[model samples]
Structures are given as C-alpha cells and as structure tokens.
Target: MGNTLKSVYDAKDNLKDYHVRAALQEDKGKGTTLMSWGLQDFTEKGDHYISVISGLVVRYGKGNSQIDETYIVKLSAPQVTKALRDMVAQGNKKEILFYRELLPAMNSELKKVGLNPLLTPQCLYANQDSENSVLILRDLCSRNFRKFPGKSCLDISHTRLILQELARFHSSSLLLKAAQGPQFVAKYDFLDKEWYNVTEDAIAFFITLFDGNIENGVAILKVLEGDKRTIRWLQTIKHNVYKILEEMMKERHSLHHCVARGLSGYDEYGNPIEAILLDFQIVRRASLVTDLHLLLNISVSGTDRKNNLENFLQLYYSSFKQVFDAAGLQVPFQFHELFQEYENKIMFGTLWALAVIPMIVSGGEPSEWASSHHRAASEEATGKQRESIDSKISSKHGELRARFLPIFDELIDQGIIH
Candidate 1:
C-alpha cells in the first residue's frame, strides 16, 4: 500500500492484522492473506481542505482464488489551514452522516415504490472524527460508472438525463416525507443549514466576471447597487440564506439539492441512461428549481439552454409528476403554478451562475470566498487575490460573457431583477 493508504489503515485500530484475517475468513470460509494493493488519488487541487479522495484496489482471497475489489476512501486533509478546518470538518461530518443514516432511509422509500434505490455508491465503512474522519465506499468506476466532463458543456441528451434523474430525486424526497411524516424528514435536518458557502466576496468576485471589461462590470455593479429590490434580496440572503434555503427545501421535499452524480452510460439505441445521484457533502433540502437552475445554467451551453429552457422545465415537471403519480401521490402544483415558482426562484440561478461561472470558465480553484471573516477584510492579501481571480476571469472573458449575458438579459426582461 502507498503511504496515504497505509496511514489511513494505521489510523484505524480496527483494521489491524488480526481483524483483516478474521474478516477474510468470514468472507471466504478460510483465512486469506492480502496479496497486494494499489492506490490512485482523485483529490482535486483546490484551496479548501474538505478531504482527500482516493481509490484503493486490493487483491485478496484464499490461495489460488484471488479476487480484486476497488474501494474509494475519503480522508481528512492533512495540515489544513486553521481558517478552513471547521468547514472541512462540517463537510466530512455531513457526508459520513449521509452515508450512515440518510442513504438507508432513502433506499427504503424507493423500495416501497418498487423502484431501484438512489444511485449512490455503496458505503462499506464510515467513521467521523474531526482529526481522523474517513469514509470508504464502492468505487463506481469499477462498475463502469463515468463522471460527466467538468470542463465541457453538456449536450441536450445528457441534459435530459440529468433533468430526469433530478426529478426523481426531488420526487423521492416528497414521497418519503408524505409516507413517513415530518419526523422522517427531520432526521435530515442537518441539511437545514445553508450548504453553499456564498458570501459577499464571492459575489464581488463574480461581479468582476460580468462583461469582461471594467466598463461593463462598473455598469452591472451600478445597476445592482441602485436597485432597491436587488439590494434587499442580497441583504436578506447574506443574513438568512440558510433559513431561506431551509424553507425552500421544506417546500419541495428535495433530497439532494446540490452537486450530485451517479453512473453514466449509453443504451444500445445510443440514448443516455439515467444517472444515479452521489456525493452528499453539501446536499440540502431546498427548492427543486435550485438544482434545475444550477445544472441548466452551468452545464448546458447558453444557446442550447436558451432554446430549450421552457422545454426542459416542462420535462422536469413531467418527470416529477410521473414519479409522484406512480407513488400514488397527487402532483401538488399545476404546470402554470410551477412555472411561476420557477420565476420566483430565478434569482437562485442568477446568483449561482454569477458565483460559479467564473470558476468554471476560468478554471480557478476555490478559495476562502465563502468565509465571513475573509469577506469582512479589505487587506492587501484580499486585494491581490481578487486581482488574480479577475485576471483569470479576463482570460476567458469572451466565453464567460457569452454564457451569462443572455441569462442576465432574460432575468431583467422578466422583471425578476431591476
């Protein structure tokens, strides 16, 4: 084993030699020795110290009958800066809680409706400690699961599959809540807090991405500052974004209202197959439209999103309705009503795009933009970092500008923004 994997195994006293031998004996009816193991790192080079993700493939079995199993391990980052330790600790806690508690409850609901369980990797072990947190899960790649490319825009067919799966995710939460009651929902109340770390500095960072030119940035900031409604909304979000997100979550009964994934493949007909949702670190109970808006705006190309916006919304609603009907639940909102709800939630998409597009387009790493203390400071360090982020945004100004201009225009035209 590599040093990291060895460190992980060593950190947990339960994984000592005798226990491994006993477990192997239990699995194969005789003691088997671990033949060999290899590790591959999957951790992204980001600034935050959430955790390090790695794949560990092990060969073990009784003599002459060896087998290989691949597992993904999540371990807390080593030597993290004090500024980000709490956020990292919280993320680790939530993910461990998600796998240990939430997944089983959710799968139980899916089984009741005779549907397959949610598409998350199977968790083998989870332990939470601020200093030594670790989660081991089935490696989806071992099951032929592929992640959607992060650097490219999603095509229409891929977009459709994502929408369908998102609908099922939201529908599943509603079904679970309806069947089990608020107490069942309350078990996931850990998600009641604001998951996304949006802050004023983040907002300011994104504002610099608009129009790519200083003149356009100045104009947009002027409009944003001068508009009373916009000002109030930002102020409200700054103070109570999590509470607002909690209310939205309660309203929709959504399970994974954040970045999620599952296995992806194509059918024989070449159509995209539905993907399962995974990664619950930042999962929240929020507006169903929140997921839809973020995915459509960030993943799909601007022109395709513009052309198919209404169709995609309808598709999401239809999928949601179908799942509810299958579970013998009434579709709570009419199509027009849902459309209005979508309109009301347009700000989420706008805000998310503004905050996310710069990173996506410029390939910038996440920083302490989510930190309140960082936001409060106007030091030379913050100024230098802001300039670096702006320079990165300026590098991809044309592409980023194209993607966002139309989105802003529509928000303005619809009277969603002043």
Candidate 2:
C-alpha cells in the first residue's frame, strides 16, 4: 500500500481526500449523472450511488476539466433507507455475482489497460468495514466523448465517436480474454437464464411505456409485445429483439439502412488512446458490438440522417483497429464483416431510444420518467446543471440527424432487416 493523502474533511463531505493514487485517468467535469431512469429494479433513482438498503450516501466528484489537485469526495447520509446486505442476501446469485465478480474484475482490468479503474462509475467501491459500497470515479469527460447527455437527434460525428469507442473497448476485452485465458474466465461467471429472466421482465416493463408517434409507436409496441406471437413476419421482430437479447445473455453479438460508407480515414487521435468502457451491470459474455448498437439506437432515434450511422460504424472500426494494433494482434475482423454481422442489432438501440428519449431529451424539465432519476440526482446534478444538459443536446440537432440516418440506411442495405 502507498501513503494516503491527508485532508481534513468528513468521510461523507465533498471537500477533498478522494484521489485514487493508482487511477491512470482523472475527470475534468466531463459529464453528468442522474439518479433515476424509469424504474430501475436496483433503484438508484434519487441518490447518485445510493444503496437502497444501507441508507448511507457516498458522495464522489469528477470533472473532465480538472485533475486530482481539484478532485473531491464526500461521505453523507443516504436518500433512502434499506439494508445493503439485506437486499444482497435476497437477490439472486447472478445479481450478486455481478457486483461481486464482474464489477470489481472489470475495474481491475481498466486499471491494467492504464485507465481509471471505474471507467464508468457504475459501482466501483467496497467499504466493508462501514458497510458502504459506493463509487469514487474519474469522470467520463476526460475523453472527447459524444455521449449526448440530453435529447440528441444523432450527430454523425458524435455517433461515430461512440461506435469507435465501443469497437475499441469490445475488442480490447476480447484481446485481454484471449491473452489471460483462465484468469479472465475465472473472474467472470456466465450470466445464466435467471439473469435473462430478470432482464426480460425489465425490458418488458419499458416496452409498455412507448408513447411516441402513434403508428410508429404502435409498431414499436407490437414488436415489443411479440413474445407469444406465432406469425412468420413476427419472427423477424422476435429474432431482431428477444432472440438477440437472449443470445447476448449467453454470449457474441448491428447496423442500419442508410448505406453508410466507411470513411477513407478518421481522426487518428480519436482511436483508442486508452479504453473507457460502460455498463458493467450488463457486462456478460456478449458481443461487445451488441452493446454499441443498443446504445447508438437508444441515443439517436428519429433522427433523419443516416451517415451518422456510417460515422458510428467508422468509430467502431477505427477504435477497434487502434486497440488491436496496440495489443500486438493482427486485426483479424474487417470492419464490414463486423458491421454486417451486427446490422439487425441496431433495433436494440432504437428500443433504447424509445424508452430513454422521453426521459433525458428535454434537458432540464421533468418528463414522464423524470422522477426515476430526478430524486436521485439531487445530490450531484443541480437544477442549473440539468438546464445545461439541454444546451449539450440543443447545439447538435442538425449534425445528429446528418450522422444518424446513414447508419440506419446502412443497416437496411446489409439485409439485416426484413
């Protein structure tokens, strides 16, 4: 162990004494975190990292624009009252295993990749003594990310950036698993059928919430509710939706109709200088591309332009190229091959957009799903901060559409959709 830095502050105060000496990255106030999102089963809505059971609040801060010298962490009271261990004890093994194995193991891997351990701050802390397991994170802003915080139509450039990052992150993990073999295997247990059962239920709940453009909305709903349908065409919906999710829970795993062309070249610095990953809560043995597709669709739904789709693919291909080369592996998969394989996967992204757009797009005002994250974000996201989220989304409407449509068309061209 190394010497700990000393600062006079309460364990739960947001003053200082929060730097992780080993973290390879630091936040300069890059992004914002909201507490609620519809109905999260784990229920982190009103508190940034609340333990529903523990009722103890662990306050952490990060900025993409600042280094450790300005970093802060605090310990505080919980927004809700629940026992952390009590909930853990009642939860199924896979949920527990996610926190116990995958989260910690993935954090360790991020550090190995020479980045901050908590790449996305999903949950990367464990203070067993105080019975407070929370996160102390380096913000996602450190990278030039295009994770359009609020309602973004889909900027081609931003979409591409996200795709590239996913490609890099996914392939990077694949390379690590390839290299580490048993060690990596030992760290992650396969998410079993039970996990899928839980996810299916959660997704079903969201599908019921779709209230968009009526005909389109109904079409989306019909697809979401196609579980028991025996129709042949419905099979396409089932295959595109449920089947993919099932396979994802099991293991490998998009694109659009816009017919996006791979750019001749891209910003080299945009490549994986280092890996920054997301959603450890769902980090099962899956095609990392599936996650990328889901997020991209969720992010850019209804945006007219599809080159954003092409841009997204480029992001994936380029980021992946960078990481594979750095890992000293000959980049084996061509970008087009991976794109073709993932074409249908884009529907998941659209599905996500259906659910998330209503909640996050407006920026400051409360939407249908606001209560989910609003109560939780009070600890970190102020009203002013939330208002600013709109600005991030507002400035990019044209660009987002320009970039998003091509991705959609590309998916259609690949014959990934019926």
Candidate 3:
C-alpha cells in the first residue's frame, strides 16, 4: 500500500470504521482480518484530477476454513495543482451531498411511485473533509458488472437503454419537486452556478483553438471578435447561465430538463444490460435538453446522430411520458414542442463539443494540456500546445468534421453565427 492508502486505512473516522465492520458483517463471519490489498489508478485520460480505486481482500476464519471477500475504495487524488485541487474540491462537495442527501430523497420518491430505487452502487462509507474525500462502495465488478469501452460510441440499443434510465432519473426530480415543493429543491441548489465557471473558459479555448479548421471557423471568429451584439450575448450568457439552468430545473412538464455508469453485462435474454448512472459531481437542475444533448453528442457517433437524432429524441420523450403516466403525473409538452426545444438547446451540445472533442481527439493528459493554457501569457508555449492539439485534431479530422460540421452549419443557418 502507498502513503495515501495507509492513511485511509489507519484513519480513525467513523465512516471508515463503519465500512470495515459492515464488510465483515456482510461476510457473515465471526472475525475478519485484512489479508492483502491492491490499488489502481483508473482515472481516464484528459481528466484534470485523479481518482484512486482500491480493492481490499479480507480473510475470514483461520487456516483451512478461510473465506475471502473484496471491497472497493475510492479516494481523491493525493497530488494535484491548486487550480485542479479547487475544482476537485467543488466536485467532491457535490458528490458527497448527492450521496448523503439527494439520493435518499430521490429513492424515497421512486418508492412512492412503486418503482425500484435508482440503480447506484451501494455505498458502504462516505466522508468529505476540507482537503480530502473518500467513498467506499461495493465493487460492482464482483457482481460481474463491466464498463462499455470508453473509445467507442453506443449503438442504438445501448443508447435507448441509457435514455430510458435517464428519463427515470429525471422523473425522480419531477416527483420530488411536485411532492415537496421548492424547499426540497432548494437543498440541492448549492452549485447551480457550476457551469458559469467553465463556459467562458471553454468558449475562449474554442475560439483560440478552432479559428482556422472548419469552413465557417474564421467567419464565426470574426463575428465573435467584431460583432458587439454577439459579444454582448456571450457576456449575458456568462452572467446568467446559472439562472437559466435554475429555471429549466423548475419546469415540470418538459423532458428537456435534467441529466453515467460503466458496469456492463448481459441479461437472461442475452441483451446487454442497461448502464447505470454514476458520478453526481456536476449534477444540477437544468433543461431536460441538457442531458439529452450530452448523451447524443458524446455517446452517439456523428453519422448515427445525424441519422437517428430525431428518432432518439422521440424515443426519449416517449420514455419520459411513460414514466410520468406511470407516476400519475401529467406530460407537459407535445413531441413537436419538445423537438423545438431540442433544436433551441442543441447549442449546449455544440458548446460542450468545443471543449471536449479536442481533448477526445488529442488523447493527451489534461494536466499537461491545461498547463499550456494556464501559462497562456507565454505565446511560445501556448503556440506549441496549439500545434500539438491541431495535429491531433487533424488525425481525427474526418470523424470530427462529420460530427461537428453539421452542428456548426445548423447554428449558422439559425443565425446563431453570422
């Protein structure tokens, strides 16, 4: 075990103590001893922060009658820069609150509607302090739950499963808001401004990096540079994006409001099991379209999205309606209305793509990439990073152009760009 693992295991906190006892209780053994442990850093590429996942093998009984059991532990990155640390701290706060408060309330609502609770992994222990956070969750892998390949896009079937689950997740919020009113909603409102912090930075990055690639890239840059109206709109959006998100959250009828998991497996019929939602670090009340755009953009391929976008949106709305009807709630919008909202809100996906697609293509660690921008005052370093990122984008040019050009074209057609 490393220093971080040693500290976590030796900590005297109630949460850690409870987890050790709970693990033993689940084994149904009289006594348990830590046999051995292994830690793996499973943080993805381009992740600005680190997540250390550990597996502990425990032994019960002695000699020939021993049984071994495993438990999973999650801990914050032991090392990170100050900027990254602050961002991680913010995300940690949201995730801890989700597990501690929001999830239980949502589960209660699900039960009220005679539905199974949300399908999150069972958390054995959760703790967050000023500088560090930890969560001990049941190892889903032990139950044969796997993850979808990160580099690939979801096919139609998997996409449907994800959308269905997302609809259910969003419905929980609707049910909660309807039953408990704004006060209940208010409790989870700590970081509605989360997106504001990223939007300007992302837009700046997009403009700086994407100026010469796409057909209309230069034109869009010109507008952003010279058009007072466009600049003002950007400023307005920066100032008020959180307020817009809050309003979207408050809306009852739209599937366009609101918001992942990796464990994958096959069911009795041999179909792939639905992926569970994980990571509530950035969860917020928002337009149903927020989640929809994210899913379509990130998970579905460009060609697939172009071909099946409307069908998927319709499918999502239908699923959303089914949940609302089952819960004895009214569906608020017609399919056409929802489709229009999707078109209007599709820019969210474009904005996200501006930041993420580059990273996806670059395949570079975020900390290294981010260091360049952090020192943006140095034109020499910034130019090198730009060239490196540009090369990566060129490598994946065909796929990205297919994925993003249509979105840009649509925006231009809609007069979102001049």
Off by over 4 Å in 2: 1-124, 127-133, 139-148, 190-216, 219-244, 247-279, 301-305, 362-418
Task: Please give the RMSD of candidate 3 to the true structure.
Answer: 6.5
**Model 1: runs farther than 4 Å from truth?**
1-36, 42-49, 78-83, 193-252, 260-263, 267-271, 368-376
- Compute the lDDT for candidate 2: 0.38
The 10-residue segment with the lowest total lDDT in model 1? 1-10
Between prediction 2 and prediction 3, which has the larger lDDT? 3
> By TM-score, how accurate is candidate 3?
0.76
lDDT of 3 at 1: 5
lDDT of 3 by residue, 1-418 (tens): 0122233333223234455655555545445554433444343443323444556555555445766666666666653334445555566677777777877887898887788887676776677777577776777775666666555567888887777778777777778777787686466675363522444554344343232122123223232243444434444354343444345455334223222335555676757776666666677656777788777776677778878988888888887787678789887678898788877776677665544444454555444334423344466865665555555555666655655455555555678765
TM-score against native, each model: 0.76, 0.50, 0.76
**Could you tell me the lDDT of residue 16 within candidate 1?**
32
Across residues 1-418, which tens digit of lDDT does each residue of candidate 2 receive?
A: 0011121211233212332321222332324222211111211222122122111222333443322221212222222212322222222243335545655554455555565343333333322223233334333333343223334444454455446555544665566567567676565544422322344433432232232211222333233332222223333453145454454434343111110111112235654333233323234555555666556555555452343556666667777677656556677678787776556455555544434443343332222232222123253543443444345445644443443333434444555433
